[model samples]
Every structure is written in C-alpha cells, then in structure tokens.
Target: MSRVLIVDDAAFMRMMIKDILEKNGFEVVGEASNGFKAVEIYKNEKPDVVTMDITMPDMDGIEAVKAIREFDSNAKIIMCSAMGQQTMVMDAIRAGAKDFIVKPFQAERVLEAIRKAIG
Candidate 1:
C-alpha cells in the first residue's frame, strides 16, 4: 500500500481525503493543516504521495511544493484546489506537483490522481 500525506486547512476536508484513500487501500501516514507542516511531515514521514490543498493559512501549497522539491527532487505531490483556479493549478504543476485535483473532490478522481502520482 502506498503511504499518503494529506494537507488541507479544513479538518473535514482532510477527513474526507483520509476516508477515500483508506478505502482504496492506501495507508494515510500523516496529515497537516497547513503547508508549512506539510513539508515537515513530508520529510519526516516520507509518504509516497501527498494530496496538498492550494490555499492554506501558512505557506500555501505552491511554495510548499517548491520547498519540498528543492530538497527531494522526486517528491510526488498532487495539488487539490477549488475550481476556477486553473492558473494556480498550472503553477502548482510547475512547482513539481505530479497531478492536480479540483476540490469538492470526488473519491474516484482522488484515487486516480493518487495512483498516477505514486506510480
């Protein structure tokens, strides 16, 4: 099972992501509510994939992706954000995210992104 880290400002959003990944047999090794903690957890836990929320109170996901990539070139990240932020999503991809998911997330889409990201 692939280990996953979920980063979202909303507790409910993180819970939803955990539920989806666990149901798909993915091991959720850690979670962070902000981008700063996301990178910390990424380094400490070394999760196989990360589902990162774009708009968080501290650090934001784009910069976090860059920071993590600077340390670990092969870090697998999947950006998760609300619709209508195509530019931000593209920016996340440029920052080394392997895939992107629009929020109000569907379980299947999340799984697909996870599968692709981890693979």
Candidate 2:
C-alpha cells in the first residue's frame, strides 16, 4: 500500500480523506491541519503521496508544494480544492503538484489521483 499524508485545516475533511484512503488500501502515514505542519510531517514521515488543501491557515497548499518540492524534487503532491479555484489549482500545478482533486471529494477520484501520483 502506498503511504499518504493528508493536509487540511478542517478535521472533518482530513477524516473523510483518511476514511477513503484506508478503505481503498492506502496507508495514511500522517495528517496536518495547515501547510506548516504539513511540511514538518512530510519531512519526518516522507509519505509516498500528499493530499493538500488549498486554503490553509498558515501556509497554503501551493506554498507547501513548493516547499516540499524544494526538499525532495520528486515529491508527489495532489492539491485538493473546492469548486471555482482554477487559478489556485494552476498555481499549485506550477509549484510542482503531480495532480489535483477537488472537494467535496469523490472516493473514486481521490483513489485515482493517489494511484496515479504514486505511479
């Protein structure tokens, strides 16, 4: 199973992603409520993939992607955004995210993004 780290400010969002990932055989290595914690956990845990929320408290997903990519050029990050955040999504892509998943998430899509990212 691929190890994953979920980053979202909302506890419920994190729980939802964790549930989906665990149900589909992905191991959740860690979780963070904001980009700062996300970066720290990522460095320590080194998960195979990360699901990053767009609008976080301290640092946003785009910045986190850049930070992670700077640390590990091959980091696999998947941005998670709500509808109508296309520009931010593009920014995340530019920052080195491998893929993106829009919320409220669909289980199938989330799984697909993670699978493709890890691949």
Candidate 3:
C-alpha cells in the first residue's frame, strides 16, 4: 500500500481526505494543518505521497512544497486547491507538486491524482 500524508488547515477537510484515502487502499501515514507542520511531518514520516492544501496559515502549500522538495527532490506531492486559485495552482506546480486536485474533492479525482503522482 502507498503511504500518504494529508495537509490541510481544516480538520474536516483532513478527515474527509483520510476517509477517502483509507477506503481506497492508501495508508495515511500522517496529517498536518499548516505548511510548517506539513514540512515537519514530511521529514519524520517520509510518506510516499503527499496531498497538500494550497491555502493555509503559517506557510501555505506552495512554500511547503518547496520546503519538502528542498529536503527530498523526489517527493511526490499532489496539491489541493480551491476554485479561483488558478494562479496559486500554477505556482504550486512550479514549486514541484506533481499534480493537483480541486476542492469539493471528488473521490475519483483524488484517487487519480494520487495514483498518477505516485506512479
């Protein structure tokens, strides 16, 4: 099973992602609510994949992606973004996110991003 780390400021968002990932055979290794925490957890857990939220307090997803990439260039990160944040999404991609999933996350899309990212 692929190990995953979910990073989102909203607890409910994290829970929702956890449920989706768990049901689809992905092992959620850790979760973080902010970019700083995300980076910390990424270093410790070293999960195979990461689902990162673009907008967050104390660091945001783009910065987190950069930080993680600095630590591990091979990191596979799938950015989660809300609608209307197209610019941010592009920035995340530039920061080394392998893929992205828009909010109001559909199960299949999330799974697809994860699969593609991990592959």
Candidate 4:
C-alpha cells in the first residue's frame, strides 16, 4: 500500500479523507491541520503521496508544495480544492503539485489522482 499524508485545516475533512484512503487500501501515514505542520510532518514521515488543502492556515498548500519539493524534488503532491478555485489550482500546479482533486471528496476522483500521481 502506498503511504499518504493528508493536510487540511478542518478535522472533519481530514477524517473524511482518511476514511476514504483507508477503505481503499492506502496507508494514511500522517495528518496536518495547517501548512506548517504539513511541511514538518512531511519531512518526518516522507509519505509517498500528499493530499493538500489549498486555503490552509500559515503557509498554504502552494507554499507547502514548494517546500516539500525543495526537500525532495520527486515529491508527489495533489492539491484539494473546492469548486471555483481555478486560479489557485493553477498556482498549485505551477508550484509542482503532480495533480489535483476537487472537494467535497469524491472517492473515485481522489483515487484516480493518487494513482496517477504515484505512477
């Protein structure tokens, strides 16, 4: 199973993603409620993939992606955005995210993105 780190400011969102990933046989290695913690946990855990929320507190997903990529250029990141955040998604892509998933969490899309990213 691929190890994954989930990053979001909302506890419920993290729980939802954890549930989805675990049910589908992915191992959830760590979770973070802010971008700062996301970066720190990422460095420590070194998960195979990351699902990052865009509008997080203290650094944001884009910045976290850049930081993680700096630490490991091959880092595979997937940005999780709400509908209508096209520009921010573009920014995230530019920052080195491998792919993106739009929320409110669709299991299939999430899995697809993760599979494609880790490939």
lDDT of 4 by residue, 74-111 (tens): 99999999999999999999999989998899999999
Question: lDDT per residue, candidate 2, 23-110, as tens digits?
Answer: 9899999999999999999999999999999999879899999999999999999999999999999999998998899899999999
- lDDT by residue (22-97, candidate 3, tens digit) is 9999999999999999999999999999999999999999999999999999999999999999999999999999
Stretches of model 3 off by over 4 angstroms after superposition = none
Q: Is candidate 1 or candidate 3 better by lDDT?
A: 3
Off by over 4 Å in 4: none
Could you tell me which 10 consecutive residues in candidate 1 have the lowest summed lDDT? 110-119
| Predicted structure 2: lDDT | 0.95
Against the reference, the lDDT scores of all candidates come to 0.93, 0.95, 0.96, 0.94
Query: What's the lDDT for candidate 1?
Result: 0.93
lDDT (tens digit, per residue) of candidate 1 on 1-117: 899999999999999999999988999999999988998999999999999999999699999999889879999999998989899999999999999988899999999999987
Model 4 residue pairs with clashes: none
Candidate with the larger lDDT of 1 and 2: 2
Instruction: Count clashing pairs, candidate 3.
Output: 0
Which regions of candidate 2 are displaced past 4 Å? Answer: none
